[model samples]
Target: MLSRLSPRTWLLAAAVCAVLAAGTSLVYGGARVQPASWPQARPEPIALGRPPALPWPSHGQAAVAVAGQAGTLRVYGKQRPVPIASVTKVMTALVILRDHPPGGPSIRVDRQAAIESGNRDESTVAITEGQSFTERQLLELMLIPSGNNAARLLARWDAGSEEAFVGRMNTTAAKLGMKNTTYTGASGYEPTTVSTAVDQLKLARQAMKDPVLRDIVATARTTIPGVKGEIVNSNKLLALPGVVGLKTGTSTPAGGALLWAAHPTSGDRDRLILGVVLRQGEPGDALEDRKKAAFVASRRLIVAAQRSGWAKTR
Candidate 1:
């Protein structure tokens, strides 16, 4: 009966078989067939342009360090040891991360950090005593808001005493060759705690290497478990382009100081750029002006580094 079919019927039956015998394949008899071959094309590489010029500002001591095969720095008065203000928290954070990994045990906030926060009257996340937070969360509180209380908490947690933690800080600084650096407290609140711009830069470089600390400092704002609202970053430069983590400081002696870093991005193929601005603003300047001076100074150095093309070896 199959062999007796007419020519057109045979053709139609073959087409039906072709459609059904494919075992649910997409190819059909009436479907348009596309070309099996295609033209080959490769995307052209982008040409790197000349770096823009970076103007050196006159009001502050600053430096810019690039991270790469040949890390170089453009600096002004980086050798002078001065007060780093709250920038000490960077060291506090780095030391804590070095000893205790990010996901370590939760530490209950003691009244000491809260009492010290109120006594110092500096920036704080207002974490009450008996409130529990992970080491990572405590880091966010310390670095993001420049919380002195948080620094003290980490210090005590790590060394069992603030003095002992500070001792370790000095030991670490010495090991890192921060010759001009000194630590009197976990927070940079003590005028006695001092360091050169370059020394802080060294600390910043180390801090940026840690994923947990890097992520925490890069956050613009974060809410503490017990705190009511977001504790924003004290480093105002964080809002600027390419400006990322590290720390900031301001005090009667320290003036305004900032340790800032820039990460790699598609638009800027350059390596990491770290900038530090120390002793900015006039003695009697407004509070915001003092703060803005450090931020602006740090941003200027970053602009210069970017303009000069961080890829070029000095």
Candidate 2:
């Protein structure tokens, strides 16, 4: 009966068989189609631009200021105020130093400062109420270890309240030409407290000018009497060669950031770099990388200076 069909019927049967074959193939083949050679896909290429007159600022909100005997490089990030984390303590120490130069009567830790200890997850010097440390030691605690208790203690000692002390911080920043900087608290835990990298570079440059500030930040280990034992500078860069003085900051909102300065031993010139990464995925590692990158970049600036006869290479 199949062989006896007319031409039109045969054509119809052929079409039906074709449809059935296609359906069978689809049912047995599964949804995924395997490609030949695994199909190497090319990613869209990024076009390179002329490198900026300066090295590109580290990714994210960053500003850099490098001035050695060689020359100077300044760059600004998007002008948005962002929390600076413990970098605020740099200004705190500056105001403290400005109000009470290194060698005055020592300030004793009070209850207010002690109360902040181990709270808010802030870094501390473990200062106990009634413990007495020199203003110099406290400054080390504030800048080196980023001691929150030390900041509160200094604020209490200087202005009788952290609030009033923050006022002084803003005032001091304004005096130093940090137009975009503002301080809500000396501890820098408040997200509302913010500053720009450009502003931080100004404060860092000024802080580096102070011999006392320079000495405090350069010290890798300091002995501050704690409730139990001694506290030390937590800044790792202190041990790194060519690093003179600087600060590090981190918070949930601020991510990891650093303001750094380096001067070659042989050269009278120095380079300053401010790096900030907001909302980084891994803050601790990110900060270390930023520091290492800053060191390399600053060293490059120093070498450039030497090549230009701006600095002498020993």
Candidate 3:
């Protein structure tokens, strides 16, 4: 073939062969080619300064954090586990909603519930035995009024026994990374039900994700069937600006415990702030006084958090 072609034509064929070999080499090469911008590394946004100092309570334990974000923003007082009172109902509500959704079948008010409701020492929503309420309604009774009986009833209905339901509650706490939490009862009536502020703050972050729970906790007051007067949310912090749902717990052993969630007035609506204040005062103090102390401390923390721009920051 080389002898048959003219000199100029042979040179042209040789050039074409070289070009093909180059193309083949490029195709078989292990190196990957990409657009200039595609391979360039992006600079990560750096945190500009330390997290602003929050006005943490001087007594008891407290923690503040943000939803959809990791880690606590600030903490105060002791971090050890202590009685959490009715805040235990938050876990109960989560478990109920997990096993039985909002609109599921109604649960009958049992003798235990009626007995609990009649007790003068505990917080409860009065209900007659044999009367029934749906899952959503029962949740309202449990969370809004901080009903002790309603919590236990929902626990039993979900797991066939309160003890069994408490096991589930502990399991759920462990799943949520609440290592310092322990649940001996769904109602949190027993002094044995204990948790730390940091642990409860973690729970607040997760519980607020459920829209149903969010709605119920944010409700300040509501009327339920068979209940005479309107039932009010124990979390008085709901009255504060941008404040939303969460829960409150109070008992002789727990003192006053609160877990709260909120958003800033002038920031992204999706941004949520979470807080927990526990054992605000001496346990032997009047229940209302102790609860008021918790509310006051939480109010200070939330306001300080807002002023410090927690909602707008990372």
| Model 1 weakest 10-residue run by lDDT | 32-41
TM-scores of all models? 0.78, 0.69, 0.83
- The model with the greater lDDT, 2 or 3, is 3
lDDT: which is higher, 1 or 3? Answer: 3
Q: Rank the candidates by TM-score, best first.
A: 3, 1, 2
Model 1's C-alpha root-mean-square deviation from the true structure amounts to 15.7
Give me the runs in candidate 2 sitting further than 4 Å from their true place: 1-58, 67-71, 226-230, 265-314
Candidate 2 lDDT over 1-314, as tens digits, reads 77798999889778756755454332334674322332226765643221134444355455544442223434545767788788788888888888888788878878877777767676776767788888988787788778888887889889988889988999898998989888999988788889887777778778887889888878877575553555555556556556666777777667666666665444344433333333223455555564454445444443333334322322
Better of 1 and 2 by TM-score: 1
Highest TM-score scorer:
3
Clashing pairs in 3: none
lDDT of 1 by residue, 176-287 (tens): 8899999999988898998887787777777788888888888998776677787888876677676677788888788888888875343455457877888888999865
TM-score pick, better of 1 and 3: 3
Candidate 2 residue-wise lDDT at 6: 98
**Candidate 3 ranges with C-alpha deviation above 4 Å:** 1-50
How high is the lDDT of residue 299 in model 3? 91
